[model samples]
Target: MAGTSTGVLMAELTTTARATRVIAAVVGVALLLAGTVWGQDDKFPFGPFSMYAGVNGPNEPAPDTRVEGTDSTGRVIVLAERNAGVRRAEIEGQEGAYVDDPSRLARIADSYQRLNPGAPPLVKVALIVREHEIHNSSATGRWWDDVRAVWDRPA
Candidate 1:
């Protein structure tokens, strides 16, 4: 009688576990479908990955944005994540805000100085967008820099 009761309890637990899994799977699928239909980049894991979903024309110039700083020593430094602790994607995502408010770029320079204490202080910071000339869906080894925003320290 004891052995039969134990077996029945195990079977019930297994059945419960299976039902829970099914419900979770159904909810996950529903969320994914809904996210795909109406989600933006901020929705992340459930949303359609917009970066991969985007398409560029074969002959369109591809934009590559970067932050550049002119230090006191008169050297132009490319402030990448390694140097400035700011990612290119982060800058690109807020391109418009930087354009609207150029002073915001001073924050990036401050970030760079904080990360590299020994380095020369940045006197000028500029947000540059380099458009690589594309032909037949490939780079043509030609590009132009568009200075979108500039932040100069008060000397």
Candidate 2:
């Protein structure tokens, strides 16, 4: 009778342990799904630079453009020009040194023209600079800057 009781108790304990493990696994999976969903959702604060679609320049004021959507890589993609518009433009960057390369700029301009046929060429392009900080275990801190371009078309 004693041996039987002990066996019964051990079985019950084993069952409980197995049940707990299963519950934990389920919870873990749920948390992982939640995290992925949250990451995919919009409304998250993106990078430092925000894109302006219509027209923004030195003398002119910024246009009232809404953020259409953000890509999976967190790049802000906006519809600067739509519906067979004349011009289109985009600016993308992360933390790094800021430089305005004419070759790259020309490519961007060409892309804009192609995307938005009949749109006026980009008259002005401005680069907004932002700073980022990185920390390392070697007790060293590094700071870098990045830039995003803002282009404007003649109205």
Candidate 3:
């Protein structure tokens, strides 16, 4: 008798698990549809997959940007390495903000010098973004860089 009861319980548990999976799948499909039909402005809690279009194929140019700094002695340094833990994406997204108010860049420079006491004093900081063209995804092509932003310390 006990064996029979345990068997019934196991069957019920299996059925419940199947139902949960179906419900989860349905909910996922609904979210995908809503995200696509509504708008790409983050209607859902997460996102609509900004770059769902996939890569730029085998031949294209990708963006590569970083901050370069000039030390007090005229030595070049990568400001991104000592940017007070700010990532490249965050800074790039805030490009307009930085351009509007360059004082923020100054604060970041100060943070870099403070964190790396042994490093030389940073006098100028420039954000450079480069575009590198790729050929057949196997070889790199022509590349060009642009100076997006530049900041210097007070005399």
Highest TM-score model number: 1
Residue pairs whose backbone atoms clash in candidate 2: 86-118, 86-119, 87-119
Q: Give TM-scores for every candidate, taking all chains together and pairing residue i with residue i.
A: 0.75, 0.25, 0.59
Compare the candidates by lDDT and give the number of the best one. 1
What is the Å distance of residue 129 in model 1 from its true position? 1.1
For each of the candidates, the C-alpha root-mean-square deviation to the true structure, in angstroms, is 5.8, 15.8, 6.0
Tens digit of per-residue lDDT, candidate 1, span 1-155: 22474465333457889899999999999989998999765676787766667678999999889899999999999999999988886788789999999999999999999999999999999999999999999889999999999999998
lDDT ranking, high to low = 1, 3, 2
Give the poorly placed runs of model 1, Cα more than 4 Å off. Answer: 1-13, 23-43, 46-48
Cα deviation of 105, candidate 2, in Å = 2.0
Q: Give the local distance difference test score of model 2.
A: 0.40
C-alpha lDDT score of every prediction, in listed order: 0.89, 0.40, 0.72
Model 3 residue 89 CA deviation (Å) reads 1.5
